[model samples]
Target chain A: MNYFDAQTWIGGWPFSFQPAHRAATLARALRGEGIGRALVSPLDAVFAPEPTPANRALLRSCRTLRNLLPVPVINPALANWREQLAVVARDRSVRAIRILPNYHNYALTSSEVEAFVSEIQGRSLRLVISMRLIDERHEYFAMRLTGVPTGQLDRFLERHPDMPVLASGLYRTDLLSLLPRHPNLLADLSFAEWFDIVDQLVRRLGARQLAFASHTPFLITAAALAKLGQVGIGATDLTSIAHRNLERFLKT
Target chain B: MKEDGRGRAEAAELIAEAARFGIEHLVALGDVLVYGRRPAAEQVREINDDTAWLVQTFPGKVSGFCYLNPVLGEREVWREVERCLGWGARGIKLEIANNARDRCMQPVMAAAQAHGLVVLQHAWSMTQIRQRSYHTDPEDAALLAGRHPEVRIVMAHLTGCGIRGILAAKPHPNLFVDTSGAAPEAGILERAVDELGPERILYGSDVPVRDFRVAIARVTGSSLDAETRRRILFENARRLLKLP
Candidate 1:
C-alpha cells in the first residue's frame, strides 16, 4: 500500500548523527521504504528562536520534489508570527503549517496559539502540532525538552472543539487517553507502538483517527511501515491509516 | 513479553500471538525481578517456576532461561540455576538484580560457565541517567564479558544501549547485543552491524512491553543487506541457541 508520512524532517539536527536530512535524499529514501508522500518540516525550527528562515529553506529545498510537501514551522510566540504565516501561506504548495509549542516556550492554551489555530482555519490550511521530535527518556541531556502534556492538549482542544488538529509524536497511551475527550484531534503513528499496535488501536480509536508517520531521519522508516504492514487489520482501515486519512486532512 | 504493570495476558494468548507472527521458537526469560531490582528467594523461585511451566507446556516452541538474583547470595544463585537447568532451561536470565559489574555477578558467571549456559543480561546505555549501580548498562555488560571470556553474554536492548552500547560490545567476541528495547530509532541497527557485525546481534522482541510487529521491523526495515538481515532475524539466533 502507498504510505503518506505525516511526520518527517529535513535540515541538520543538534544531535550527533542523523540520517540524510536533505529533501532530495529524504524523498528517495522514503520512496524506497514505500512512502508515496511526506509532510516535511525543518529540523532547524526545533532550536531556532525564529522559524521564518528555516521555513523558507524548507520551501526552497523541497521545490523540485513533488512527493515532499513543505510544512513550515511557525513559532507563534515570536513577535512577527502573523508576518511569518503570511509569508508561508503565500505559497500555494504550502497546504499545512507545523508548530513546536515546547521548543517555542509557549503554553498551548495561550492566546497566541488560539489565534494561530483560528488563522489556519481562516486560510484553509491544516495544523500539525509536534508534541516531540525525540523520545523524552533519551533527549539530549542539555536540551531537556519534555513532550507537550496531554492536559495542555486537552485544554487546547476544549477551546477549539471543531478545529481538526493533527498531533505528531504521541505515545500509544497518551493518544488513547486524549482521544476520548477530543474527537477533533487526529494522530500520526510515528511514536505510538505496542504488540499488535494497529489492531489494538483500531479496536479502541478506530482507523480513521490514525495516519502513517515514520518520523524519518530520526526513526527507522521501515520499522514504522512494519507496524502497518504486519498488523491484523482490514484492508480498508489499512488504506485509511496509510494514506487516505492524511490525504483528506490536507486542504485542497 | 510486554508487561506494563496494568493487565495480565494469558499464556495461551501469548502462544497464539507468537504463532501468528510465525515465531516457532521463544526464549522464555521469566518476569525476573518484577517485584523490584532485588527480588526475594521465593519471588525468584515463583518467576522461574512460571517460566518452567511455559517451557514445559510449549515443548519445542519455547526454551526456558533460569532467572537468578546474584545479590541473594551465591548459594541461592547456584540453587536456582541448577533447579531450572534440571527442568531443561538452556540459559540464565539476569534482570536489574544488580549491576553486571558488581561483585555479585562473579558467582553468577561462574555458575553459567560451569553449567555451559548462555547468559542474557538486561542492559541499556545509562550514560545520561547514570544509574549504573543497579541498572546493567552496556559498558557494565561489556566489562562482565571482558572479565569472563568463557561465558556467552547477550546484552539486552540495542536501541536502549544506543551507539555507545554497540561500541562497547564490539571488542568482546563473547558479548552479543539483542535488538530489543525502545522504539525503532533509525540507523542504529546498521551502525551495530558496522561496529559489531551481524552475527554479534540477535533479534529480540521485548514482547508485551513492545509490539512484536515493530520489533521485527527494527531489523527487517533496516538498510542492511539481505544476508545480514537474515543473520540478525533468524540465522544468528538459531546458531546461538543451537536450535535446528
Candidate 2:
C-alpha cells in the first residue's frame, strides 16, 4: 500500500541505536516501509538554539531525495525565528514548518506563537505542531519534557480557529478531546494507540480529520501501518487515512 | 455476571481479525487478577474458568493459561493450578500480585516446573516508574530466571521492558521475552534479536487490550531478517508450546 506519511524525522538521536539517521537512509527506510512520500524534519533542529542551521542541513540532505519533503523546524521562541522561516522559504522543497513548542520551552498561548502563526500564514505555509517526539514516561531521565497540554492546544486553536494545523504525536484521548472543539485541527496516527484505533476514531470523528503518520525511525513503520489494517473500516476510509487525507493536507 | 456493556468483540471476532494477519492460534491468559493483586481463591477460580470456557469455545484456536496470585500462599497457588490444568490450562500466568523476586514466587515456579508448564510473568523496565516492590522490573525477572533454571520463563511486554529487559534475559537460556504491550518502538525488536537471539523471543498481541495488527507488526516491521522474524512470530512459540 502506498502511504503519504505526514509525520517522520531524519538525522541521529541522542540515544544508542537509530533505524536511519541521514536523509537518504531515512528516505530508503520509509520506501521500504511502503511510504511513497513523507514530510521529513531534522532531529537536530529540536535541540539546537536556532533551527536555521539544522533546517538548512535538512534541505541540503533531502535535495536529491524527491520522496522526502523537507519540513524545517522553526523554534518560535528563538530570536532568529524569522531567519529560520526565511531559510525554509529559500528551499523550494519545503511546504510546511514544524514547531516543537514543548522542546522549545514555550506555551502555545504565548504572543510569540501568535506572531509566528501569522508570519507562517503570510508565507502561505502550513503549520505542523509536534506535541512530543517520545512518550514522556519513556523519555530519557535527563530530559523529561511533558507534552503540550490539551488546554493550551484548545486555547491556541481558539485564537487561530481557522488555521489548518496538523499536530503530531497526540494520544487517542488528546485527539478525541481536541477534535470536537477544534474542527480545523488534523492529527496523525503516529503516537495514538488503542484496540481498533482506526475504527474508534472513524466512528467518533470522520476520516477527513485523520491522516497517516508512521513516526518513522522513532516508531516502527510497519507497526503503525498495521493499525490501519485489521481495523474493520471501509475501503474509502482506509484509502483516505493511508494517503488521501495527507495528500489533501499537503496540497491545501 | 456484569459485562463491560462496551460491546467488546468476542473470540470469533478476535480470531477473524487475527486471521487477517495469519495468526491461527492464541494463548488465552484469562483476566489474571480481576480483583486486583491479591485476589481471593474463588476470584482466581472464576477467572480461570472463564479462560477454560474460552479455550473450550475456540477449541483448536485458543490455549488457556491459569492465572495465580502467589501472595495467597502455596496451598492456594497449587490448588488453583491443579484445577486449571484439569481444564486444560497449558501454562501459568503471574501478574502484579507480587514482584518476581518475592518469596511467594517459589510455590508458583515450583508448580510450573513440576507440571512442565511455561510461566508467563508480567514485567517492565521500572527505572523511572520505581514500582519494583510489587512490579517485576526486568532485573527482578532476571533474578527469578536465575533462581529457577529448570523452568522456562516468558517475560511479557517487550516494549515496556525495552533494551534493559533484553539485556536482563541475555544470561538465561531458559528465559524468553514476548513482544506484547505498549506501542512498537523502532530498533527494540532488532536489539532484542541481537542481544537474546531469535529463539529467545516470541510474538504476543496482548489482545482485546492491544490491536492484533499493531502487535504483529511490531515483529513483522522490524529490521530483523525474514528467518529471525519467522522464528519470533511462529517457530519459537511453536517450540515453546510443543505445537506440531
The C-alpha stretches of model 1 lying farther than 4 A from their native spots are A14-16, B1-9
DockQ metric for all predictions: 0.63, 0.63
lDDT of 2 at B71: 91
Q: What's the TM for model 2?
A: 0.94
Off by over 4 Å in 2: B1-9
lDDT of 1 by residue, A36-107 (tens): 999999998778878889888999989899999999999999889999999999988999999988888998
lDDT of each residue in B1-244, candidate 2, tens digit only: 1111122246546655667778888898876645777788898887777778777877888888888999999999999999988988889988888999999999999999999999999998787676789999988899999999999999999888888788989999999999986778888888888899889999998876777788888888877789999999989988998876
lDDT (tens digit, per residue) of candidate 1 on B1-244 = 4232322247547866887777878887877647887889998898888888887878888888888888999898888888988789889988887899999998899999998899999998775676778998888999999999999999999888888888889999999999998788877889999998779999999887788878887888887899998899888889988888
- Going through the candidates in order, what fraction of the true interface contacts does each contain? 0.65, 0.66
Compared with the true structure, all predictions reach lDDT values of 0.86, 0.85
